[model samples]
Target: MNAKILETENVTVSFEKLSRRASELKNCFYCGASLPAISGEHIFNSSWGGSYKDKNLICCQCNFSFSNSTDKAFIIYVQAVMNSWVFKGQRHQEVPKIVLENEYFLDQGAKLKLKQPLIEDEILPDESIKSRLTFNSKSEAKRWIEGDGMATWLGRLPLAEEQEKLKKIIIETQLDRTDAKPQPISYQLNLREQYRSTAHTILKCLGFFLPEWVQGDLTKPIREFARYDKGDWRTFAIETKELFPVAEEATRILGLGVHHNSVEVYWNSSTKIVVGVLTILNRLKRSVVIAQDYSGLDSILYVVEGTHGSKKPPISVFTEFAQKQFSLPLLSVQYFSSPNNIYQYFHDELQVLMGIYYPIDAMTARLIQKIEKNNKKNLKLDQVSLEEYLNLFLSFFLDLAKVASTSVDMTKARSKLIEYGFANLAHQHVGKLYTDPDVESLMTLAFERTVKDFHAEVLNAG
Candidate 1:
């Protein structure tokens, strides 16, 4: 029998650590044999009624094929992952759960389908939480192109080895990684296709877990999944099928080749274009960076057009901010050369930024020097004394400043600032509506005073 493709919708999962006292807790919950992570048993069994809720943990070697012949519990388990569930109490405290689903087609060559849902919504800020999804195929041809047939990837964790490997594959695929290009990914797809014959083998698997902060809101929620890609920083795109909306997004990520952890791919409904980021963090060991971006849509810095010169932010301005505010130290708040300098900055001093994020390190100091150099070029001013450079840099060039290449109405600017995380520091200040535009002067003063205050806060926080 060929494995069928199955979709898991807004599946909710969690994990718990079992004490590793072999002599104390080695018995399987089902039969009391030695435990290895857990004993394997079908999530659903007809004899136990139709629900995954009644799963009985059995030892891995002891699960003697409780075939579909007698259990309906696995059937219920499959359905729950796709549908939102409302549970009470410390839900994660319950035993780790698994959602079992498989395409049971009789034809050996028949293709099976599987999909994992994500989220999206209109009117919310760009970085707001929205559901998303993915549709994968298990047939040879499609699997060759798509990578992995009825085989699936787990995003969240606390699973046994095999499940962890799948999770790592997904993470590697999603981040901006070294093998971010198409060739590596295509090669991997070919490899997974070679295993199409085993796609429906019904191996044991584990469900995913949510981050500590987010409670279980499978419907409209936020989550943290383990992810990474080799940072050799490569990126790619995919076309979207008409079935889902928000399929066209401008975001970019790294593709860390075949085996590294990668996150689920993104779909954009707006333009029918999808972009995925990948990176090979360590080419030496061939490791990848996963869960690299948490600011959501911050992956794409979208500044309203024509706002920068007007003292408002240009789209390019926001991209830099996205990189700074969300990217980890190695990736964010760095002084990458001149042209790139324009990508990220805050309205406050780097020292202030250092405070919010922690203290400034030597790398950041070099970055500050880089930004000052770049800013000098932008102003078209002649070479000045080091003191002048220091004053200008100290006054306006914030390590995490909101750089505007244009001007906008106070309301819109404030909204954009807050949405982009500047809310952590800066506030919107309204100017006299009828006065001649003195936006730069206004910005300079606001930036200076605000930066001073920010530095003080950082000192206090520290």
Candidate 2:
């Protein structure tokens, strides 16, 4: 089944056209203010390489407010991950100061007091002592490097009393990283606020695609909920209990294909639920999903489906009737990309997995039974050749490994596969896939095969 690949040129063209249309929108979608003056609002923050912006959709005041409040929180939440990735081809200028035993480890243990801009030669390959040689006072310099390699200080501590005072100030200002040994650095995150920020971003993006009619009525409510109103927006931005395996696979695929953040919106008409997903920096961090109840808002759903020539892809939409029965809408939007075949494969696999484990409600049991019956009809085992079965099995395991890696430490990902029940499938045919002797070898093989298969799928689909 040959599929039309969305080329980079095509994506850029489509996105630019969309941006132009969005810019023509007259009112601030969040505040309903007249856009007499507007500012370019990036769907994702520019710090993370998001360049797409709409020039006229948002009022300057709304844009500034979001930037200062919710957007600031979002940036803080992902700053650590962004720094680790060195996003936008630049290293972070300022990071959380790391202090060890009252001594600062500036720039990842560089031990340099930066007084001026870094020149080309300062970015050295080897670890060498590079001093800026400027100080506010001799006493400040003495206190800063009391025990370091460059602490010679011309053989004397001239301002002993002042240096002691500076040392005491360091003790008060610095965070002690020395005592927290053998443990990973932890950041205190306000989960509720982060989720709220996620909700606001999702709604803000939705404002772009939604029709003016739907936007006219819903924008005010969405704006209030996303901005000022403290009503339970948590329902829209609930976190998954377990990490999504498909998110890991999609992140990998997207990283290789698109160099920008991707947004996907999904709506279920029966349930009146709209789900928005935002993937940042190609999934170096977790993907955020926001689901909103729009059951009575069929017009909005219709508008989204018809807007921007948004055609449905050639795949089945995984809907859970169970949620509707329970008066709960369960819509999920995932932001990831894959080659056509791999995309479809993961889509089908995730549907089955979700139907099995993360069922929407009690009615999901019935939905699962129906899905299994339909699968039996659609997938003919007897017509499947031995080689095809092996390829499919290998792809499944590889995807599982990829997902496991994202959920936990990479070193322990293989073991986690076994603990998470992936070993059972492999054990039946390929022996213990994650056992000690074969674990390392199998893990390497799985990752290699996954990449190889992904390329093959891309080629075949194209």
Candidate 3:
């Protein structure tokens, strides 16, 4: 360069290009594994008619693991709610019969069924042994006989001769009817795993909506509890004070076409927490803390409604998006007293569901549609004609009974509906129907009788 300075100017030039192909790869939130492009995790399980899914939330391996562990436990925990709602989602798995005390089963139709394959023996005056075997189905009877029916009768492993003798007795006995005394029925469910699984649902929802936020350090406790069964789940999950909607309220909020599930995430600014609320079949409700000690945009609400053929986008509201809409911060309400209180809440919810559920088959669906249409039309006109009111009440409540598992005569059901409707209307103004004690008592007795008749019909039909 010094030598060139004498002759001409030394020239130097450099050209540099920077290129970056932004990585779009997604990783599992739980296991931190590369996620398959085809894999998706359901925020609400498919068993609840949930179609919402997140592709990058969790890897297939973690999803499968949860399915086998916490997911299964959660299903067992809500067996009664699932069976009562008749929520046979895409999988359409048979609703498992709920086990009850004293060798009984609560069927999907809320019928108390005697667990079958029963053997009763009697000693006759002639000192002869008479035995009877009762089974639910031919397959059950065959399986018992082929496996160890004789062993059961002998109270131990049976000898070859003893088995032969039992077979002869079974073959010779004729089919006859016998009375069975109803035993007290109660249920007990373990809540520990269920609590963990419930918290898992909230975590999945958080991962679904706010992937980056959920992966941060704040959500680690819940993620650990949900995935590896680590940590005290109660700190993150609790049954909230939110009351599950009754059937009428459910009908108003969610359409009658299908059982609906809902997941809502909101920030409790007062508590510096992010909370996720889950409601299934509009019956079981719980709240889970997704994040703690959060300093972020405060007002946030994310809601996803899961239903049959659901396609609506999630409703997301943020402080920046709608400052005036939710200026008031959402404060935290105290959760239920203890996790154990969930048992009573579940009991009450099950009782309500069993009392109100009428399987919505094609016929019931059509009837409900008609009633809803008529009610809407009447309400638009500001007054319901007597005929319209009576018809709506009868079709909605009483007509459904006819198409149910129990066969109540249409004429009788209609008459009863009208009778109750008139009694309810006669006691008060249009808005206060069924508010009077006498009307309520009458309705209560009618429902009790209807339930009793249904039980009897189911027992006899079987």
Candidate 4:
């Protein structure tokens, strides 16, 4: 935008206004088009009310393409954490349409709703289409840089004169420009650009899909899984981060009468695990079904400690409740930080399950099959020792491709790891193929996280 609105506050968004008129119907929300298309879109704003479709915006053809079964599930996920977001708890007014349609859009995991977009107006999408983008409205620009939010009840600081002046400049700029056409200004510390930068970097590395709601309010990262016409819940919702002392938390809350189930996706902090667990933990009796991970910690462990016994410890809620009620002590443990003795404590049925996860299994199979089928004479699987590596790489690629289709290319993949076997794959990683193949990166992450944990455990033990 042409406006050089000064930074009034420490925020990224700044205010700029144009005399008002209703929205123009020139471009399609899903696919920007000038042609004769369906008017007055049918849309789904997944980020509404935890997740509800309070709206829609689309053209006819685009709507049809998104009608398959898994579409709703994916769509629901797109609305994750979209309720209302406050960067450090500071926010600005609604973004103007002109800013969204500009060359520099702010979306990281940018997916246009087929028939409806959450924010029907123009929204910015950045380099990585699968990253979450949060752009401040003109009024919010100053706060972003200043990093100000509502004053906490206990510690309120009076603003200095200069700071107050800066805030006025920024907010005043949100008003319509006095003379000529308005424009967006850029300073090195611009919040919108900086936020876009961070969001883009995170998504690209994680191969994550940024749902529309992530930037709103749902204070957490959200991971999207592609559903291939599965007849689960026109969409089904699973909180990968949802775990507890959950299976155990169940029995305590439900009084041993209710039954429960839980699932797991380790190392993913996508959504607030606390909220997801609390919502469902009591509903299901100390029971949860989890996606067993490659990591050895994927076992289900029961707390043999009875609620009434001295050795048994109650959950956080009960402990806190009891403390509040009688000034007593009921113990609890972080779900993830469970003791290793869990194997000795729980039943055999709740064991380390190497059962391949559904989409992951389906994905692995396809990747393996494709690589096997596509092996040219010179580029055979034997030549690369890549049967396993290719399988792993393709599984990850297909996953990323589903969300960031534009950023990935399986057809163009050429890895020496795919040209040689295990030892050669190792050599290739240490040599030339480490950057693009992905298997190397995956292994690196696994190894690094493992090593870090090992060191942490040792430090704790000491």
Each prediction's TM-score versus the true structure: 0.15, 0.44, 0.55, 0.18
Model 1 scores worst on lDDT over the 10 consecutive residues at 179-188
In lDDT terms, which candidate is top? 3
Per-residue C-alpha lDDT of model 2 across residues 162-195, encoded as one tens digit per residue? 5576566544553322211111222334434555
Report the number of the highest-TM-score candidate: 3
Clashes (N, CA, C under 3 Å) per candidate: 101, 0, 0, 69
Cα lDDT tens digits, model 3, 172-265, are 7665522111223354444556666677776665555455666789888888877888876557665443222222344454454346665556
Q: Which is the winner by lDDT between candidate 3 and candidate 4?
A: 3
Better-scoring candidate (TM-score), 1 or 4 = 4
lDDT of 2: 0.39
CA lDDT of 56 in candidate 3? Answer: 62
What is the alpha-carbon RMSD of candidate 2 to the true structure?
18.4
Question: Which of candidates 1 and 3 reaches a greater lDDT?
Answer: 3
Query: Which stretch of 10 consecutive residues in model 4 shows the poorest summed lDDT?
Result: 83-92
- lDDT of candidate 3 at residue 30, scale 0 to 100: 81
Off by over 4 Å in 2: 1-20, 36-38, 88-186, 211-219, 240-259, 284-462
Residue pair clashes in candidate 3:
none
Cα lDDT tens digits, model 1, 18-123, are 2212223344432345544443333222121112221123455334423322122122221121111111111123212222233221111111223232223335
